[model samples]
Target: MWEQIRANKRNSILLLALMATVLALLGWFIGRAFSPDPAAGLFGIVIALFVWMILAMVSFAGGDAIFLAASKATPVTKDVHPQLFNVVEEMAIAAQLPMPKIYIINDPAPNAFATGRNPQKASVAITAGLLGRLNRDELQGVIAHEMSHILHRDILFVTVAGVMLGAIVLISEIFLRGMFFSSMSRRYSSRSRSSGGGQAQAIMLVVAIIAAILAPIMATLLYFALSRKREYLADAGAARLTRYPEGLASALEKLSQNTTPLSVANKVTAPMYIVNPLQKKGMKLSDLTSTHPPISERVRVLRGMAGASFADYSEAFRKTTKHSTPIPSSALKDEAVQIRSAGSQKSADSKKQIRDIGDIMQKTAGFHFVNCSCGLKMKVPPNYKAHQVKCPRCGKISAV
Candidate 1:
């Protein structure tokens, strides 16, 4: 695990540096297009560095809040959802990490994710649909998977990478838009066309255009690469933490069968989810660009595990996928084994689970619940101002 963390750190640094270089080059070309002075390129580099720093600081400080808000997730208390809270607590303790703040997204997509700068500041957010669909062990599997992301520092790495990637895209967009709309750009082009070094300037312009177009794509590819690998590792960590590989395997199967697209998830936040929330249909070339490995493959690897150790997962991964380097050597452990095949457990009652989840979500969202004589529970929102409310199920009036 330490080796993997070190490797991720090194890779993150390299990736960020690569993004910075792209930004600097883009800035240099834009500056040179307007001014012939060599110092303009240096100025561009400085500007790029400043932008990167500012954005990085902002993302580090408040990205988690922004994500939660974007997803319409509300902070959840243990009292409102003791089962979810207990599962999170158990996973946190098993991973030997600080408890992450919990959130519940109101969406009905069966998905979950973890985010924050580090374990101390980490948070886990799951959709209401996930809570409704998954059984206790399945939920444990999902939570454990997210907790592994926190423990392994994948959240921090991904957050920093996302910030840098956003900066690159933002700068590139600014440059492209400026060139298209600014009169100064036209003047620069006219002047450069008339200069003695017109051919060189033309070449630089072409290079800049290509770089602007490709930088974001390249960054996204890198981000996806890192995301895919970290997911495999997180899965292994989850299996080790829960001592039940089948739990996660079964959860993956259930998630893959879910077809609902998450209303709040977008491209920027989709990769953070345990399962891709975008709900792509049919095999296409675009699947190659996905941030997650194929769900079926992940499930196969997990179900192939003969025990709950990292070594067992590693071996299973190799046999299942012919990938020999998914797990680091130092992280592998050989211990007592208890293996259960996928589908070994009985399915929970889905209607009951959905009702329980709805109640928990309503309570956490600050809705007042009143059970009427008609056996129907009425949920009044926090914004309701009336002192007395009439039951929708029964004509009985209830006092707030």
Candidate 2:
């Protein structure tokens, strides 16, 4: 595990540096395009650094909270969903990680993600749809995957890389938007023509324009590549931790079949999810620009695993995806792990799951629950102004 962590750290640093370089270059060119002065290029770099620094600080300090807030996730207690909390606890123990905070998103899209600077500070947020859909074994698989992210320090790198990517995209957007204005373009052109180095300036401007257009695309590709690689590692880790690849494979199959769009999801936050929440229905995520690898491919890799070890996952990944696994050789050298048998526990019916999830969400939303003698459960909204409420099903008056 330590070997894997070390390798992941090394790879993360290299990727971050490359992303930073892209941001710096984009900043320099955009700055020079706006002003003919060479110093303006340096100024652009500073601006880029400033943006990066601000985002980095915000992410390091409270990134987990920011993402949870963005998703409208509310912190959940064990009582809300005993099985979900139990699975998280079980995975944390298996991963030998500190228990991470848990939250639930109200959205119907079945997705999840982990965020924090480190394991101790990490948080896992799951959509209500996920809690309501997955069975115990499936939920355990998902939690194990998230716990692996916290265990391997993947969240920190992801947060940092995401910030850098955002910086590059922001600068490029600003430059492109500025270009649409005649005055900005004419000002630079006039200055270039006034100097004897008009041709040289024109070339630089052209390069800058091209860079502005391509920088975001390039950064996005890098970010997606990094995200996809880590996901594979996380999946492997989950298999090892749970000793049941089919659990996760089945969960992934269900997640892919759901067509409901995630209400709070956007491109910026898409990569954090276990499955890319922004993926369009029927879209192939195997493409270069997608944040996540193809769900079908991931499922195939998991289902094909011969055992629960990293070595097994690597072999399966190679055979199924036709790509070299990202797992470190040292981690794969651990003792062989025999896959465990499937659990005998049967999950509640779909209607029960949905009802339980709704109850949890209502509690999270501060709705008061009043039990009526006629076997009717009255849910009073938080906004109810009355001191008393009547149950429609049982003509019973309940005190607020």
Candidate 3:
């Protein structure tokens, strides 16, 4: 795992540097277009780097909160969902990580994600639909997968890369939009073409236009590539941490069956999800731009595992995807782990679970809950003026 973490850091540096190069080039060219002076290009580079640094600082300071807020996630205490808290704690202990703060997204999509700059600052959010759908073992597997992201330091790279990608996209959009609404491109092109060394200036202008147009697309491809590989590693980590590939395999299958799109999901946040939240149900995500690997293939890899070890996962991944081993060779040198037996199956009352999750959300939203002696529960809205409320089911008066 340490080797993997180190490799991840190396990859992070390399990838971020590549992304920064793209950003700087775009900025330089765009700057050159506005001003033929070569020093303007340097100024553009400085501005681009400055913008990136600002975004990185913001992401490092509070990116997790922003993501959670975008997802409409409500923080939960252990009492709100003991099962989830216990599972998270259990996995944290197994992974030797501090317990991450928990959040529940009210969406009815069976998806989850982990976010933060690092392990100690990390947080995990799961959709209510996922909680209602997966049994305890399946839930544990999902939690373990997220915990893996924290353990491997994937969160920091993701946050920084996402911020970098955002900066790139933002600059490109602004430049293109400015060119469209203003006469900048035409003015610069005609002026340069009429001036001395016009040919070189014109060529540079063309190159800058191309860079502005393709920079975001290229950066996105890079981000997606990094995201896809990490998903496989996280799955492997989940398998090893839980010693049960079937749990995640089954959970992925169930999540795949859900078609509801997460309302809060967008391009910037989509890659962070356990599954690609933007993917349509039954659609195979095999394209280069996909934020995640094909769910079917991931499930197959997990189900095909011979043991609950990194070596087993790498082999399974190789056999299933026909790709090179996803796990680092050094990490695969550990002792073999025997897969654990399946946990006891209990009937899941999905409707009841959803109701309980809803109650948790309402509580977070300032709704007060009162238990009636007649076995009825009443939820009083925060704006209600009355001090007491009568249960609709039993007509039992209960003080708020």
Runs of candidate 2 with Cα error greater than 4 angstroms are 34-38, 182-197, 368-375, 380-400
lDDT per residue as tens, model 2, 327-372: 8877889578999999976677878978877876787677878888
TM-score (C-alpha, index-matched) for candidate 3: 0.91
Error of 1 at 100 (Å): 1.2
Assess candidate 1 and give its lDDT: 0.81
Any runs in candidate 3 off by more than 4 Å, and if so which?
184-197, 347-400
When sorted by lDDT, best at the front, the candidate numbers are 3, 2, 1
Better of 1 and 2 by lDDT: 2
What is the alpha-carbon lDDT for the whole of candidate 2?
A: 0.87
For candidate 2, what is the TM-score?
0.91
TM-score of every candidate relative to the true structure: 0.88, 0.91, 0.91
The lDDT values for all models are 0.81, 0.87, 0.88
Provide C-alpha RMSD values for all models, in order: 3.3, 2.8, 2.7
Task: Provide backbone clash counts, one per model.
Answer: 0, 0, 0
